[model samples]
Target: MMTTAVPAPAISVRGLEKSFDDLRVLRGVDLDIERGSIVALLGSNGAGKTTMVRILATLTRPDAGTVMVDGFDVMTDGANVRECISLTGQFAAVDQILTGRENLKLVAKLRHLDDPGGIADEFLARFDLVDAGSRRVAGYSGGMRRRLDIAMSLVGNPPVIFLDEPTTGLDPEARIEVWTMVQELATRGTTVLLTTQYLEEAEKLADRIAILHEGRIVANGTLAELKELLPPAEVEYVEKQPSLEDIFLALVGKNAPEGELR
Candidate 1:
């Protein structure tokens, strides 16, 4: 008889809670992010989204409960947890004085990866930074620098990655680029903890969604599951009194003369 291997969760949080003085930031929250899955954490401002990311990243300690990443306890095995995880913040943290290639090399050295130059070159090509590899990061555009920051965080080849608003300052095209990178990472068996304000982004990227409100997980499940919790999906057809597109055509002049109606 063959014994099956029981895989561990990439991230597990149980009764996690945090508070600053009398104000609770996370109140007995529970979350489980499976290996290779992208779980989106959604919430409004001051909703404790960043707080949960910080706790899982081992940057800040939770006041109660436990957080385990790759089977290592975040509190007791912080170093081990750090080894298994990479965290990227909302703002890009690229070194302004260092060239893009140099930045990658620095991270490689820090992570003790072999052949820092080769690894840097590989990531440069992968992230579309081959042309900017020798350019000082200070001269790089916002999107380019953001890409470099994410690339640097991948130096350790960690099993889990925490992305706090990964596309915060990007244009739509750049945002899609990040989305593609994230999907590729997940496909390659990287577990991602994604925090975002954009519902459409979460809809596109998340295998599961957890909504935080007043520091607690108010809802959790797949997109359809959460939607079910709110209200049943309904289809309503209304008679169009000259739809918005018709008005736009009247004002802008329909250059195509006729367009296919969806």
Candidate 2:
């Protein structure tokens, strides 16, 4: 008999549960995030999307279930898990008192990254923040601050990044900028786990999507798969006067009959 080795999931949760008093935030949620892929968690308010992200980031502990990040158990090896992950919450965490360059330097120093100055400068150039890097974060615009905050998260070059509503208050342009950065990160083989309320963002970036409804995953699959789970997937027909059927028809002619026009 030969034994096969299983490649570890970038992040994994099994029978995960979390409750605050009578309000259960998560109920036996299970998920596997593969290495170098982006997985988006989607849901309405109070859907436990952020809670699940927190658990994976090791900020919160589950009442029951096992979580592993980069093959380290989050419960017992949290420090190691932290070393393998980076998290940027909904709000930008840049210190207004510090210059953008200073902020990156701080994060680099804290992460014990070699040559903090060089690392900060590299990120400054990479994020196109070089000109603004010398300006105080307080003087920066929302997008600039957000970009700097994201730059800090990359100081250590962690393999897995958890981005929780990263585009929350960003304008459309800023959001698009962030999306490009995310694509670049994924291209470099970094695994990303993102939580977002914006459907477009998930549709555009997620390799897979999991929808949480009332503390449980109501659906999980690739964007196409989840779309298929809805109803009619494809249909072809010709229309001119724009009748109900014509309205239902798509320009591409592939109609997902299962999914509503959302």
Candidate 3:
């Protein structure tokens, strides 16, 4: 039988460490993200989530240990690492003065991709921004801007994406909209490393969750496995009720435009 070698993980980190002056942000952190999977990195404020992501994106140098993205060593092959990944920061990095379509074209043109105009149009239609494509991004809603930001990240169709708190500052409806876009990425076999403060977001999106606590990945597993780490829950019966999210979505999702805030 002919044999095919297994592909490397989309991202790999081993004994990673970073610090600023006296404060150590990441300490002996180790993580791996399988290709085409969505892995959530969960940590509290100052728990080094952003630091971990920055290192992965090659924006910050690690104090120690090996890090790799798409089989390229981040330390020695920074350019190759960058070529394989896109980083979408907490805030939408769109030019406020440019129309939504212009923002997408700019990223494509910057990458020297052929047919920037067509690429921009494709993303606009795919992201449901065709209607707003001509409007300056300054007038865009929170969800629309985020969609465009992510659309821009997809310009080269890089194999890996780093979304740092991708849905920050969005209303409930907008948050759901962004979540759908993320799911679509995974379906298309794009690897994603997501850092977020929202526990529910991880619960909903991640195939596996890695919790960074006390400068290390204290737990990494599926939701069921993580739940198993705690003592079994007490069994009880109560009247069933809708959560705030349920009620909010019921009243908002049906009537709003795809990603517009209600």
| lDDT leader | 3
- Can you tell me which runs of candidate 3 are displaced by over 4 Å? 1-4, 236-262
Write one digit per residue (lDDT tens) for candidate 3, span 44-158.
Answer: 6898999999999899999999998999999999999999999999999999999999999999999999999999999999999999999999999999999999999999999
Q: Rank the models by lDDT, top first.
A: 3, 1, 2
The TM-score of candidate 2 is 0.87
- lDDT, candidates in the order shown: 0.84, 0.83, 0.86
TM-score of predicted structure 3: 0.89
Please give the distance, in angstroms, between residue 104's alpha carbon in candidate 2 and its true position after superposition.
0.5
Angstrom error at residue 146, model 2: 1.3
Cα shift from native, residue 37, model 2 (Å): 0.4
lDDT of 1 by residue, 63-125 (tens): 999999999999999999999899999999889999999999999998888999999999999
Clashes in model 3: which pairs? none
The model with the greater lDDT, 2 or 3, is 3
TM-score of each: 0.87, 0.87, 0.89
User: How far in Å is the alpha carbon of 94 misplaced in model 3?
Assistant: 0.5
